[model samples]
Target: MNENASSDVKAKRQILIGLSGGLSALADRMRSQHAIATKITTLAARAEAIAQRSWDLNKLNSQDLQRTMDGFVGEIKTFAKQAIDAAVRAGSEALLGKEVAEAIAAHSAEIARLTREIDSLPDAAAVRAILQPLSVTLNTLPARLKANTAMLKDVDAIGALATGLAERGDALAAGGTAGNRVAVELSRDLRQFAEEATTFSLKMASEAALAVKAISDMAQRTLGLSQGNPVSDQAPSATDRLMTLARTGPQAGQVWATSVSRTSRSSPVQGTPPGVKW
Candidate 1:
């Protein structure tokens, strides 16, 4: 019984340590994943800048080309969000418990918090200067290009348009490269996130197994000790071991209260009633 009690304490202590370590690991992974998300956001911003440049250049008259670039940028953002969501959800499912539900909720809330933080940033004067001009330029491009084409010769205008188209193509290609980077970073971080969560859960599970073994040993020892055992004057007797079991067993509080009642009833009291009420 003594050995079992010692083992149970050790097991409970190990379980606490394991849980603490696992939570620490999860916190670190969240930060790492957040860094990856930030990188993707930065790349997405660069891609948007490239697209904005392409739009400002007005080299391509085709709306379809512009739409394609816009679509690609949208896809990059969508894919980044989807990758994180899936990774978190997969990790939660792998753990398959209340903690799993809580983790998924935590990650979701974290993403939303990040989004709010981004939205709360003050608009930069420099970015506004560039983007406002680009918007005005795009808005007036058709008229400006048409007027210039009428003033210039057909051949000269065609040559100018071709140069503009080449520049726009280069900008679009740059945006595509940026989008690729976002995808790569997201994919790599997602795998790491899943692995970290899964590993932490497995370690926690192992600690839980130890806790179970200890409890089972404790129960067996409790029954065996109740039949009495040999002991010296210093060593724990059967009653001492039984008391220890009572402290850890179910209805511990009730048993403690009942013991206190019995002690009070047996002890000498100066002026206490025989049948005291709660």
Candidate 2:
């Protein structure tokens, strides 16, 4: 009977050991599941916060773009007003025909009105539609005025108009921050206008003896504007490069002339140029 009791006690101890080991493994699994649940909650909260911030940023950017557009429109109106005033003054002085002055004022008014309409545009495409005709009008104005004999006779009047337009264009270009595509394009347009005005001034200067002083002043301002505001980091076109060089002095002009002659001689000719023999 004593031997039987000893075996029963050994079996009971073995059953207790098995129960303890099973309970320990169950506790470990519960802890692992709790850790995984906590990690999932943390990641979800982080993602939600990021999404909210992104939405706010998009709203701010949209507001900022509208403000920029408004500022650009204001500058354009100012530009049109000043140019119109110059043309009207010249007309009153009999430097150009009254019809010409009326035409200029009419064109400028249309440009200003169109510029105001840009504020109501829904997207870039609509704005570009307005800008297309506006650009053509702006580009053709100086040439049209230059074609009139009466207008070209008064060099001072032409100089006044050119300089005024250029100054206002510079101001308009300053309305936006760096990296803004609109500002960069406006700056390029200003430079091109300056170059064309300078060319016109030089051509008229050759014909008028007493107009030297007016031409000099206009050249100085326009050249300064062109040099100061570059649209990009890319190298300037060959025409622009030579134009800049030609502005320095007579010596620079001579150097450009020599280079042109050399290029002409060295270039291979597939056919004779117009008004030239083979």
lDDT of 1 by residue, 1-278 (tens): 47855554444333323323333333333333234333433433444444444344344445654566565545534543443343332222221122221222222222222223322323333223323332343233223322121111221222222233333334444654354444344333333333332333233333223323322332233222222222121323445434543333224232111111111011111111111010
Question: Model 1: what TM-score?
Answer: 0.23
Tell me the lDDT of model 2 at 120: 46
Top lDDT hit: 2
Pairs of residues at least 3 apart in sequence or in different chains that clash in candidate 1: none
Candidate 2: list runs displaced more than 4 Å.
Answer: 1-63, 91-187, 201-278
lDDT tens readout by residue for model 2, 1-278: 37755554444333323322332332232233233323323322432443233233224464675555555445545553443343333222221112222222233333333334433444445434543543343334334323243332332333343344444445544544442444444444334333433443333222221122222322232232223322222323445434543443224312111111111011111111111000
TM-score of each: 0.23, 0.22
* RMSD vs true structure, all candidates: 33.2, 39.3
